[model samples]
Target: MSSIQDLETWEPLLRLVRAAHAEQLAAPGGRFTGQISLGSWTLPAPQPRSAPGRALQVVDMQDQFTAVERVQAALRADGASGVSYVVETGPDGRPLLHVITAGPAVEHGVRSPFVGALLLVEGAVPEPWRRLPEEFPGAAPAPSADPALLERTLRERLPDAIGATAEEIAAAEARLGVTLPDELKALYRVTRARWQDWSGDYAAQERVSTAVGCELFPLDGLYIADARSRPCPWQYAAKDAVVTAPDAAVQGLVGSPGWIAFGDNGGGDRLALDLTPGPGGHAGQVIMIDHERSIGAALRADSLTDMVVNHRHEWRSDVAWNRPPVVVQVSTHSPVGIAAAARPELEVLRIGPTGAPVSLASVAGLPRLRTLTASPGTLADPLEIAGLTDLEYLSLGAEEWRLLLSAGAVPRSLSAVAIDVPGDQHPLPVLDLANELLALWDRPLITRTVLEGDLGTDGKAGGTR
Candidate 1:
């Protein structure tokens, strides 16, 4: 039960809101908001029927009044759609802080900007804004005296905060030689209060990310410092846009775009590489790259094109490199070559239907090859894949000719096979593929079929149900 004074920045304030909301959530009829932002964006209100159960419960607790009757009256008076409530175990008893936000209801009914502002009024001022205590003399300080200023700060700093964190990461990568995972890099970009390293500086690195944007880089992931030109580990979606910057360090000449590089000598795009498992004990056989674009593509090898045949340029910096400029590009370049070059003992290969023909031929001699995923790839090399008798799971893509032909011909030592072949797409029946593949397995395979017109409908089976 820390006072609002305990929280100076919006981060901690948001944290308190979350904690208070969570406490209220633990009680009956308590609810909190999904996101804590200024009442600017046109969000939908919580509906009793539409937002039933947890969905209905999770309202903007920070915005509503504590009294249930007051909250209900406010909602009815304002003609608002929904209000969130937090059940706080006060000295007296379990009291609630009701929250509401501007949405379609406010737009059509009130048509007043003040309505949005009114919802943010606190019973007491938080400590962060004691100087401007009048804002919420009874509750917590709202910090910025100017309501518009507070709103603007959140709008500006939220994205900038995201960018700043990215910069810290890029600078770190530039210091180290490896590009981080898409999930990991995303963890840095999304605005949240959890990024406090032991130093407690708000991961101050984000200051740099906000400065750089589409003009120079994508500003999507963290910039890294690296010595070796390692592969990136970001999974990308196709709708994502990628632009090459003229700056050599960022233009995929020395490193990938949307990423900064810090070489060992601080000269070219090379940086230090950390193959060891990071802070948590979770480590993997990774090919760390130096660019965010490549990181995006590499991690999403199935969805996007790799960095093959793309334009390659010279290093932007004038310094000589102790190590070769690791070629950086999208994820779908020559995967066969990448796999061969990686020569991973345990690799997760992401091939497309186009590269399916030569997939296993390249990784045939990979003594360390362990796990394989033929994601986004139409079909895998049945004969070539069969050779890897130590395989754990073989996730089949839309392509089935290769796997269908192998049928009972597969290795008996294989463990699991996740098939996603739809009936209409396949000339052969799904049952035939399932029956044949099941016969060759030492263990029962997790078989699945995509019925015609029912291509992506099962949520539990990776596709939509």
Candidate 2:
């Protein structure tokens, strides 16, 4: 058997738990549960208190560290991420230890310790990441855009600033595979913004920031902030919807190919020139891509010339106007029912615990519906999910998944799936269900080894159970 399945491998950790929680273990119907990984842990063991004269040292929890280190070593040897553990009093008044490791489909560091598997088919991404912006036929450069005026302003602001050569600008265009916007080119022509040009001078960089109204990136640093550039995990990315307001200046998208990132807002947010504008937007409008957000850019200025001349770096408004009810959650707390949420614009629907199980018939034919997440026992009939033909992502409880699997009614159009394991349910059954889902897409299955042992009546390590 692998070390992960060997009783000896877990004895040290069990002994530490028994020692720390002796009183609790001695109590009637006592139990303890926690999870541990290479980098982090959540255990019932007591933490070390700082000494009078000094802060707490690693030696204070030396025994705890050593016990966890052994388990981590076994995990590394077995190519596993982490393990969850359960300890309960046995008939003989000794502690029983159950170590559980999740399958490959489940993400590590999840607190629940059993299941929340994300089954992704090869090369498949969340729908929002795959969504491109809607085309705007009448989009054009802003009226305030003036390349010559921008260059002249920069020269007037920084007389000693060195500019890029025409050859350098052409090379950048060729490298990026897109023509640089005229305003961007003009800004760069005044100062290349290379650090080496300033000779390690902090004041020079500050002066450039003051003149440019933001921290500028060098010509080589400029890149298209496409959807691929700002990556979010499938669970989060699936919930987002791309919704552009008809009268807005920026198109709501994960990222745009036309968004050429030229600088930052001193904070981490990016400043980009938007080439793909919304219906009411100008092609060369300046937009700020927030570092905290995964989708959409905020309009910072109508034009780069406006930004530089008028110093319009402050956000006009971060909120998206004319946003439709694209995401709907149906639950006991939700204001809208499933029938009320069945709008054509609805892209995501989440079914939480409700007074009664809901029917999918209400939201079956939503054109833009791509994501659906239903909590355990929230569905009146799991088979009704087959009607959601456009579902790209679906997350449901294990029992609900089993109903669909037994009836051969799993959605073929799904790009990804998730099995939500609730409470302290055993990992073995959850792993089986997760493997079955993975097999549908020919993906790898989650595998685990079980180790069983006992803590003796005296609160010391005992032989295998």
Candidate 3:
């Protein structure tokens, strides 16, 4: 047997678990579950608490640290990334250990026992990230826009302010690969707004903020807020939709190449000039990209001049368009059923646990449907998903995936996949199912190391090898 599979290699870690969960393991059918990797762990060991006037020292949890280090060293030697383990009492009143290593389908550093989302097709991004803003020929500068007035107002507000040179402004524009707007250039020409120029003066910073109506970024700090700038994981990103109302002033998009970020709202939100405006918007309009949101920007003002001179900082919410939702969830809590969510605009569909099994017949031919996630035992027939020819991402339970794999009906259009493993299910079957999926795509399979050990009846490790 390999060193990793040797009983002695896992004794220290087992001892640590037994020490912490003795009473729980002593109960009938009681089990302890966790995951561990070389860099991190999620064991159920007791955490060291800090006392008054003193911080916790390494000695407070030396046993835990040492035991975890031993397991990590063995994993490194065995060339494994992580392992999920389950501990339960044997019939003879000793602890039995089952260590399951991760496969390529499982993402690294994920503490969850089940395989989440796995990217099968390389370099495929979520649908929203691939979407771009629609062109509006009627878009033009706002009537309130006056570069001369904006520059004049700043000069009067900060007469002694240091401004950037024409050369400095040109360098910034070149670096960002986009021409700076006239109003933004004028603002920078009056004051560069660099920290070094302010010389650590809080009053000077306040004066600049008062003059510009917001915290201003230096010319060199300007960047195009493109879709790539705001990145989200595939699991969450797949559920988002890009929708813009007909009368919206700003386009609803993940991010835009035309958005030039220039300042902040003092609360981490960004202020940018939108050159590519929506149908009812003006060119060079100011928009606030809220830090808390992943998609869309709120219109701050019609133009930069209007924002600074008129103090037009009122935030208008995105217009509510009466269009069908692009993402839909079918559960007991949802108002709409699968039939209602079967529109051509549907991109993501999720089926949660319901009273009866749901069928995919309603949403079978959705042209734009790219993602589908279903809970275990929710689908009436797992084979019904074969009709979803356009699916780019699919997540199903182990049994559902097995049915698909058995019939050779796994969607070829899939770019990624995930298997939802139940807590009560053993890892051996889940790992096998994961490998089968990986094999279908010619991806690397998951490797396992079985380490069986005996923790004596007295809660002490007895096995040496």
Better of 1 and 3 by TM-score: 3
Q: List candidate 2 segments past 4 Å from native.
A: 1-18, 21-44, 52-54, 57-109, 114-117, 317-324, 452-465
Clashes of each: 68, 0, 1
Query: lDDT of candidate 3?
Result: 0.81
TM-score, structure 1 vs. true: 0.25
How many clashing residue pairs, candidate 2? Answer: 0
Across 224-286, the per-residue lDDT of candidate 2 in tens digits comes to: 999999988667778888877678788888888888999999889999998998888889889
Q: Over the stretch 216-289, how does candidate 1's per-residue lDDT look in tens digits?
A: 12233334422123332111111112222222121112223222321111122223112222121112211223
TM-score of each: 0.25, 0.84, 0.83
Model 2: worst 10 consecutive residues (lDDT sum): 456-465
Q: How high is the lDDT of residue 67 in model 2?
A: 78
Minimal lDDT window, size 10, model 1: 300-309
1-465 per-residue lDDT for model 3 (tens digits): 556666676777787787888888886466777777788888877887867798998888887888788778888898886677777776666567766666655564253454556767667778788888889999999999999999999899999999999999999988998888999999998999989988999999999998787899988888899899898767667767888888999998889999999999999999999999988899999999988888889999999999999887788858442235777888988887888998988888888877789999988887899989999999999999989999888889888998999899999998778887656665557767878888888876766554445553333344422
Q: Choose 1 or 2, whichever is better by lDDT.
A: 2
